[model samples]
Target: MKRVLGIGLSLVLTLGLLSGCGGTKAPAGDSNAGGNAAAVFKIGATGPLTGGAAIYGNAAKQGAQIAVDEINAQGGIQFELKYEDDEHDAEKAVNAYNNLKDWGMQISLGSVTSTPAVATSAETFKDRIFALTPSASAPAVLEGKDNVYQMCFADPNQGSASAQYIVDKKLGTKIAIIYKNDDVYSKGIYNTFVSKAKELNLAIVSTTTFTEDSQTDFSVQLADAKKKGADLIFLPMYYTPASLIFQQAKSMSYSPKYFGVDGMDGILTLENFDVSLAEGVMLLTPFNADATDERTVNFVKKYKDLYKETPNQFAADGYDCVYAYKKALEAAGCTPDMSAADICEKLVKVFPTISFDGLTGEKMTWAATGEVSKSPKGMVIKKGAYVGMD
Candidate 1:
């Protein structure tokens, strides 16, 4: 009986040691923790996952996931993505960035909006991590950050391109502007748009502004634009305020041709929004879901199948950002085991030398200044859908 008991005890100890040695996996972000760590790279992103701007954040997250899935399936490169919620607040964005840093994020898809992106980008600059923002168009996001880059047109580019598009297409004559004065994204676009419009000799009839605390109502601004005899109304703001402006204008019977920049792309997706209010609305954007190219058709079909809605410019931007990173990584011959600082240095040296064709644009190249070069397409809302105007 004593001999049998000793054997049982020895077996129990052996089993316990085996379980301790092989049963647990490493943390998701630690590349040196073993178990295929060298075969995959960890990427982190932060955006407004649960706020008024959730549309942009969720779209970007889903879009990037699709790209990561497709690339991993090819069995050549692998990526693991983790996204945190910033709720569109700059302070929360900094916190989110710190969380991602703790997770050992090697590459970053910075915040979806400009203000949060500005805050997170500064941290990335300090940490020696590379960041490529999808829709953060404010120039300040990349002003002094050499390791930061953009996948969407910057505000100044959008503003100047918008003015040129309006003039080239003869869309309207007298233009009135309604912009969010306190937001860097809106104000940056507004300043550039005004300068370009002045240079082009475009007639500016009236100008008005709104603050975040006062965005729910636009009675005075609409009334002034209507009274000024403006034929076109330019909205350099997000979809939320733009939607409100549209509803209020219709209620007052003050209808004018409406034009917006990329910030207006998600208006149609707004919950309880009346799509008819946006009919005949025009905007300048880089991606159009209606394109007949095989790549675009496949991407659109996959997106709609998974997301239950059409992808917007923000989604396209996110998808392009991942593919752009992939291209730059391959060109630099970067390995998953490299430190974030090493990866950052390699990417910074290689991004300007490679051209990437993505869902957003073809042959897109980045400048040393972190700006992307691509042509913008004119799109109009027709029958509750975006149609190419070119």
Candidate 2:
């Protein structure tokens, strides 16, 4: 729903050096001799295949697989996918990046979530590896790196968009918040939301916190919000904790209009959780699988047929990220065995001024800052699925 409106800033990045990323490139005269159709364009991916963030990570992995299959079928250049499980842990992600580099991976499509992406991008920044993450939105991931690109908007932008959505919709003036205090992504969005809300003259009725390792019981927080007479509640945590909050809130009979961000996107897929609990829940996200556009309908049908489940925002972004790279490669006439520097140069030079009609159902463009310039859409859950807020 959020099509990039106009031509974005040019993408001109200067990757420091690439001596450490694979060996030197082939001589100019030997372009197709040591590169191109025969050599494998190794792409490494890392995500949480078995942990709390597995929902987000696994969705991205599946989407990436779909893109890989389609790309290989067309047979432009040889490509290989090497996967590693980071478990959503920063240290584990670092290990995964190291393993991929050891295995001669030239490009990366991971680490799926923000925390891991931030950790892994540190080394990639030093090594100048070209990485385009599907779902990592924390600001830390792209602070100093020229090679790291993101498909999703950063937390600050998402938070501002959430505030704008609430204000524009006239949802409520009195807002209550219960956020994960220990998590990077949660804290980033919460701070920006609060700041924007204050600017818009919205009242903060209640503010509560919970750490990842803390108790799951949110009765106390709900009771506090109820006592404060808050009409709307914002829960900026992942679907796992948000589900627990909803269940406990329902038990306490504390019903308030619920607002969430992309972190709560996987709520419908929670194991054994009743789908009705998500009814009327509003969120701001990158993609909505139930959209009616030709691209969206085709993607949703194909994704469900392949994975036997609906695709999430992360899935859409993952699919888009691969196609973005493919477009850049095609523009630069890149071969499979180009040096990391050469590949990085091609991406930087080719991405600007080029727009992609991506699987996210948008005509998206890249910013010079390594982020996409597409707008965020507001969506609401109804009848056990997400639909446009319009």
Candidate 3:
């Protein structure tokens, strides 16, 4: 796992926009508008600032801050982001949301991963306080909610996409799954993949699982998968466990194609792990920092210059979401002092009509079901770096 350095609080917020059309636009002259006197829109962002997922939370905060700074520099509507760390715990995330709301925040940008985002949304599901998650992909996050929105392809979609990628490449007809039965994300993707693979007439040779508290060793599961002659092994979990699994698989001389999802990102930076362990490992993500498109190239450069490290998918999501929110606010003619309910109502009406083109290098839009229209890219690790699949 990547070590998270302590960052000062005063350093984080440093503190933390305008356009108009009548139907979707509020008069800049409205006293409730942010452009007016002493009206600063407050966005409360929650994520894992500490604990196992802090790396993702830190990236989200940085990307949001970049968007905040850039928008503030434009000198239109004023904005400030009040961020709270949930430590990647669902209950803690809910507490953070309540605390931010008490602190006067009307909008939210994240609860970085699916578990926490789902938790936080439960509290805001019927209210005006809207949430836009950066990386959470589980379908339940916004199942029937009107005020909540997702910023990535949902887990089920990702699973089906992975299955399609396998068929397209003719990589295998037999697949094995090794996932965490206790994790919402891993289990959700596994269920979808199993159904999709079966529908595609592919063979599922082995299905294995481990609880979150289980021992690190996966010897039994690995032996079973190998004995079943699996052409691919799916690891639907985060990088920490994924790294240990890779090391053990290499030790046992298992050389099947390994597959994963966005959570497998940052595997190359795992402490003391051999990058070679990830060679030929394939995963799905929306953003590749090294992508050559103009938007991708510029975002990567800005991210590297700001943090001295390449941006990950979560970071790109955070950046794009901020811009998306700005567009939504402008289109809805929202002002800072308007009732949270009204702001969200207007946004809900405006969202389906707009397309956002940002760091993801595609025009993204939302469905009435609150799903973000996105396609996952099949990426492979080669020479210790992510590259588009050949």
Candidate 4:
């Protein structure tokens, strides 16, 4: 778990040549579109800035800011990111959407949870602005919508992959899946894991779900799993609960082969939990470039130099996504008629061919379902560092 150091707001505003065509075109004769260009092209983000999910949101924002800064520095496209604090609440996410829409932002990357993301998507697509999430893994959020895309693989894949790994490792004949009942992200992954375990003929001794945003101890849950002879514990909840579980289990000497999906980001920050508990823990995530190629090595060094922290998958996705957009923009010829919607359309067509020479050495492409696809990479936490799973 990397320590999240708070950094002062380092928002940089840069100007780009805005173009135009019609209703969607640059507001007629606008300075950038005409002679005097404004100092920004706006993108919006809405995330939990002051709640349990703040770490995820802040990390994502930092990543996006880094991407925007790099883009602006290269004089490719200047992006102004209007960040709205959604407080990790769905209603607040809706509010953020309305506000950003009213402010005329065309793209955004945020809302850590699925419910808020789904709500925000409904509002955003109505306004024709696309929301590209870095960590929203719930498949339900993207059903029937063209404007919402998450750069990470869907939860189903992560769930199934984790289950398969557990089975292959022979870690357990019976397993317990601890999840948050109310979270779409958690429930989706949990259900998928259960299905996969069953397919592998593993006995699911117990499956339990707890309330979200609660602090009840996991002693009862852990005892139940123990009593059921469960040898593996699958937690599909986000960082906070997962950390709590790890801490409690360590206290009780209740070690099970821990398995999880990508939602476990930031678990490294749990001060009391032994980092060794993370050893052999299996979680599925997009290939981290640092785990793969030389290009990503350079990018990581550059990012750390700029932000004083190693970049996470969210930031890497944002960086790659911007490049994806740039390729599409150039493909569309940056005409006056190239509305954001047009760009998105071009993106859908071009995305399949756009390969990421990402930190994760795997070549990435979108499966027709809009979920990013690449060869599976296992992230095994070992000795305070995430080592690539073979």
Please name the candidate that would achieve the greatest TM-score relative to the true structure: 1
Whole-model lDDT per candidate: 0.91, 0.81, 0.80, 0.68
**Top-down lDDT ranking:** 1, 2, 3, 4
Judge candidate 4 at residue 326 and give its lDDT.
51
Which ranges of candidate 3 are over 4 A from the true structure?
Answer: 1-38
Clashes of 4: 10
Residue-wise lDDT of candidate 1 within 192-252, one digit each (tens)?
9999999999999999999999999999999999999999999999999999999999999
Model 2 accuracy (lDDT, Cα): 0.81
Predicted structure 4, TM vs. truth: 0.83
Worst 10 residues of 1 by lDDT: 23-32
Better of 2 and 3 by lDDT: 2
State model 4's lDDT: 0.68
Clashing pairs in model 4? Answer: 1-268, 20-336, 31-36, 32-37, 287-360, 288-359, 288-360, 289-359, 289-360, 290-359
Q: Which has the higher lDDT value, candidate number 3 or candidate number 4?
A: 3
Alpha carbon lDDT at 360, candidate 3: 65
For lDDT, the strongest prediction is 1
Residue lDDT tens for model 2, 8-42: 21111223233234534333222122433235566
Evaluation by lDDT, superior candidate among 1 and 4: 1
